[model samples]
Target: MNKIERIGVYTSGGDAPGMNAAIRAVVRTALYNGIKVTGIYRGYEGMIEGDFKEMVSRSVSSILQKGGTILKSARCAEFRTPEGRQKAYDQVKAAGIDALVAIGGDGTFTGAELFSKEFDIPVMCIPGTIDNDLYGSDYTLGFDTANNTVIDAIDKIKDTAASHNRLFFVEVMGRDSGCIALNAGVAGGAEALMLPEKDTAIEELIDSLEEARERNKTSMIVIVAEGDKNGGAYNVAKRVKEKFDFYDTKVSILGHLQRGGSPSSFDRVLATRMGYFAVNELIRGNRSATVGIRGSQIVSTSLEEALRGKELKLDEELLKIAQVMNI
Candidate 1:
């Protein structure tokens, strides 16, 4: 680990817009230090099948603005098996890999930790999920871009809501976390925000819509996370309509739309910073740790600390702002 000779990089889970930016940073920085880089295609599945290619400085050139992982990504539950993990380790040894860089979220980081522990090799993780659910880092690599995407869609939906004087329910991607929904709700000036962390006050929500009506408000927008306990948006909308006797409610599930598009200026910068710092950490002999941006500093803790399933807490200040703006 003194001098990185060859490093392998892989991405797992859903593809994020800023993934290529992270891969580019890792390759460019590693090559700058005279290290060989190998791209693991389709995640660890590619590792077992030997579906990898040598990555050069030119391989990732001009990919900073790209929207997907250059190495691609996947879920290889097979890799969890001892035989499968052994195959991956054997492949790495055969390919002369000195270190590994894994760009992904909680599940992916846990797998990287397991691989590193078994092989006793350095593994660095760059958080790349749009969910922004990963703990430790204030922001994941693709979050800014996804937030921008979510708010952009919300803005467009606003025009239609105002045109028809209707209530619009906009559901965003947040499997078990609501950082995306909560942040976008505040930014988009949504009336009520629903997240997995808290229960939605349907009675209060109905009263708010009634109040908006009494005040001659033309439109109301509710931002609900996909993981919200109330169920999918359509079911919630139906319940709202039935209980409140309100019709003409529009449902707009942002779905994977928020995960597409080019990496924004903020996401690109964050990814590059994380990627370069991760390589440096491995050079310093760090293993079983996930490099994360903690309070504007690149500090990392044990992957064990990361796997505790801690979720990002909502910023109450932003919630306050959202409430004040709605008033």
Candidate 2:
């Protein structure tokens, strides 16, 4: 049980909405507990470069509603090497940073787990990805906000598709998980969904479209996860057009738009809770764990346990509901 004094926090990997909110919560919570906080910019890159700023309660003011992270995020290929990690540790020791709080997805947790073990530093993680792919947490920090963004775009596309009598293929993020696609599909009433978790063939998609056509669906939208086997929205739309093109076909790649926006009521509150929980965990001598929400309760899991085999979050019941709703 290391007596953690000064703790450093950073956001890593891809940027997501509600990240700023998490940052705010972390900074304020640490300050409230009479702990010193340092903001690590650009993730591991910043740690290695010694790019740090002392953070206080006012440092995070008016940032709760902002999109993206104030600390920012970036991939650090250098951090993958022993030499780079050694340099980061040197910086941490020099700066008097005794512990760490990382906010990101799987890659972020993997790095934290390794760093904590090697340096024997107390660390905690906040699941701050829009993908919601992590297992321990019921919902990641930015997932709800990203879902809202996707449904907003889908609703607008639905209006245009209805007016033009078109079949729209909308692609959402999630290269490894389908949490965004599945939730957004059910919410948007998509005609079909192609997820990375499930192999959805073009022929099967055509058949589903054919059924929709028979049911006289004037305007149809199909949600495709970015990692779908048949490429992305454009390639899927092309394949579907070659086989069955009942209505004019179009493709819309939502791209990073789903990664931005003011987080919803759910995400802001969730981020705040997770951030506060993470700081407390570190102060209690807990190390190398991630803060997660089970049902209504906030919980902590060792990073080693949290980073176990990839979590398949696609809900079977949700898929059935999506199918029934489409019909």
Candidate 3:
């Protein structure tokens, strides 16, 4: 492989907490290795439009605690086309970027994988989604911070639920994964959880609520993932109300609030590690991969494997624990 002279870094897809930390690591690590870094604004759209900026160590300074990304992010329909990709390649060559470090989730990786194969430019990915649904990484960036945000809301909501003896169906931002809902639900001591991985029936949910009432529980909470088959928290709460009116029902959709917050220590460290490794891996000539952590160790998986491999499943043990503890 030719010697890498310049690397381009960008964040794409939905914004996640700790992305700036990852960007900081990528810029500083590349500079430390004597390679120039270009910040690609607005992801693929910027790549095609030549919205590039020279990145220095000072450019990323003091952004570690920041939420969202310094590079910004966007979904580019234009990037999915051959013509658009060709334009992006021209811009990348014009900017003299020899390699790339992409930050985001599956859509980001898919684009990176295609862009690398088409243009033969080395690319590495960092898992920066809060969903934690990506296959390669055990934990994605912002997952911890999102969970913390949800738990904080749950704690505060619980206060009102207790005061009114209400049943709160709190929805979190896991559209396809239950990592956020399950983890936060358990941590917040919710009475039940409706996850995407599990097709929880309305009858079963009512049973849980009825059981809670029988146990003389003053207030109950049912955490729901956004992708729950029963529709969102509002729909589930509506169905539950039709049958069981034991307590006043309410719905709290966390919405985009989960996507914004100063990253937790774990996420900051994880993003930094992933970002540092992504640059080093590209320098080492191991291209087209995603950086991830498995049990405290940072590892790289090929893009093909990371994108095509079986998705990480919800832990059955954790599911059982959530159920047992809810009692």
Candidate 4:
């Protein structure tokens, strides 16, 4: 519709594992279509600073197996201001970038959505947070890799836990979402999981652990999401140790570790498909939307719908499985 010639791409917000794969797909897909591509460094901050580089297919080569974004990412509080957006818009026009492919989580989409409306340019987003908290996409880019990374740590911790007959309180990143805590808890075979979505009181936790002790369980592992109301794993462990002293308790905060890893086959393929879909949508004149995979199909959702803070329902089935598995 805009007779597009050149496109720009950038990653913002927290970096994720499969972001490199998505970047690769975007660059190669646009190049294959005979369109020029520009890589914007450090997201909106880079855009405002005019930090850009022309990207060729080779620029993204051999990066599919890497973690994090090649374009890099940063928070740009300045970009939230009208003046900042104006400066970014001017830079985009001067760089001859008619449309854009943005890869990041909600903050990235909010920026792209606002910038596109202000300047009337096309922008498509790929959800790229390890948290997988985005609404439009069922699975965000690095979620699988992050989940795998967490499970790996948990498995190792489990070995030591069994040997020492210890109780481990493992904290994982999710911020306000519990997706990671729930999925990783199930996969890691955690004894209990505390999520932000539900109120998991210390009393209930102590009761569960007591039950486990009664069953002659010598070791325990509890997975806590960062947003849990009972504070983090440290606080939870401290409180539990005060009441239930059945096993020696230890705390492990798997902070940024989950955000780094060679993405699994699932994440790599998902990123590639999302990136390809985003470019194709932009070519077809679609804009101000995000590309997502819902039930094995690639689909697009408007940024308005995506940014409404619509929470994905907690996995009830998984919760049931987690409960049953513990017994």
Candidate 5:
């Protein structure tokens, strides 16, 4: 493989906290290895449009604690087309970017996998989504921060819930995976949780709430994942009210609120470690792979293996704990 002279780094898909930390790590790690760094704005769109900026060490200064990516992120439909990818490759060649560090979730990795294989360019990916659904890693870049944000919202909502003797159905992001909902629900001491990975019937949910009420629980909180089989929080709240109306019902859809926040220290450190590993892996002549942590050790998985359609099973133990604790 040709020596990696310069690396292009970009973030794509939904914005996540600690993405800036990943970018900083990539830029600084590349510079540390005597390699040039180019920041690609707007992900694949920037690559196609030639929106490139030379990044020095100071370019990422004071951004470690910042939420969202300094490099920014966007969905690029054009990147899916061969013609558009060719244009991106032409621009990449013109800019002398020999390798790439792609920071995003599955979509980002898909693009990188295709781009690298077609053009024979080295690429590395960092799992940067808050969903934490990726198969290869125990934790993604912004999962911790997103959970923290949800828990904070849940705690505040609980305060009002108790005061008004209300039942709150708090909806959190997790269209495909229920990691955020499960983690935050357990941490926030919710009365019940509806997860995407599990089929929760409305009647069953009502039964749990009925039990809570029987136990003389004043305030009730039901954490709902957006992709729950029984619809979202609003619909679930409506269904529950029809059957059981002992308490005032409120629906709090914490839509994008879970997506924005200062990343927790855990996320910052995780992003930093993943970012640093991605750059060094590219320099080590790995053509296409993803960096992730497994049991506290940084590791690389081939892009194909990482992106393969493996079922990301939910933590069964955690699920059981959440269920048992609800009583």
Candidate 6:
């Protein structure tokens, strides 16, 4: 699609909706190409600890639309250390893996790169996290599902906000990236959006709310990224309450909810296409690259390039749209 037989697949970091579908895609694609695939449980922790099982045609028969990762996932703090990562390298050689596919977020890519360099084993990093924060790509695999999840949650919360004539501070996952906050803010019709790129000033928010209220906007909802300087939406809500007599603001952090749910149409299709391509790339003897969605195509970038810090920059154009829409 050539040399990736007995490939080992692992999902590291947090679990997400499309991970299982991705796993299915890889396993099916590899098998169709006459290669064997093994699923590693609990990420690098499992790999270092040697917890792997052969993944067969039936192993992922019904997982294409599943919410969580079939292989499971975990943060391997141990694997980050040189000794722990070395152990993982030893395990890879011990397993006879010609190439490895790691599915997870940024930390997972860094770990895969370290192991790839140490063992001289080709490791492919697949973007499978809901955070959508990975550099070098416009979108991560689980982002569409996560964004839809946020929109659904916001729509539900907005009803309550308007009914009670209160302000809403909805926190979304972004950590250091703020992609989720920014996207969901625009999609959910948030009155104000706060991301990690800019300072979360209380005075500015208070002023905005004051103006909206005076203009007969009885209810307002604001979106905040988790890593915003003023803290999560809960903390921002508390600040608003302290600054004004209206203590009716409520905070809702979508949290892991966005990470679960059936993979959306976009995610399932993207995962399937990428899954097929990952195996094909490995067959072509490509390695140490993280495949990403660039525009409308699937492209490969060396892990070294993907790792060189693609800082998340908010679309200032979207900011202008948000302002124009007054959301």
Tens-place lDDT digits, model 1, residues 1-327: 366699999999888888898898889888888888999899989888878899988998899998988788889989989999999888888999879999998889988888888888888888889987777788888899999999999999999988987889999999798889889998898988888888876777787778767877778899989988989688778878987655479899888878889999988988888889888777778876776787778778778888785656888888778777876
- Please identify model 4 stretches exceeding 4 Å from their true place: none
Ranking by lDDT: 3, 5, 4, 2, 1, 6
Better of 1 and 3 by lDDT: 3
Q: Which one wins on lDDT?
A: 3
Candidate 6 TM-score to native: 0.96
| Clashing residue pairs, backbone N/CA/C < 3 A, model 5 | none
Poorest lDDT segment (10 consecutive residues) of candidate 1: 303-312
Model 5, residue 16: what's the lDDT? 92
Candidate 3 ranges beyond 4 A from true positions: none
In model 5, where do residues sit more than 4 Å from their true spots?
none
- Tens digits of per-residue lDDT for model 3, 180-214: 99999989999999999889999999998888899
The true-structure Cα RMSD of candidate 3 reads 0.7
Question: Mind giving the per-residue lDDT tens digits that candidate 6 earns over 169-274?
Answer: 8888887877788788888888898888889699898988887787787788899988899988878888888886463778887788888899999999888877
Per-model TM-score, in order, reads 0.96, 0.98, 0.99, 0.99, 0.99, 0.96
Over 4 Å off in model 6, which ranges? none
Clashing pairs in 2: none
Extract clashing residue pairs from model 3.
none
Each candidate's lDDT (Cα)? 0.85, 0.91, 0.94, 0.93, 0.93, 0.85
In terms of lDDT, the poorest run of 10 residues in model 4 is 306-315
Once all C-alphas are superposed, what RMSD does model 4 give against the true structure? 0.8
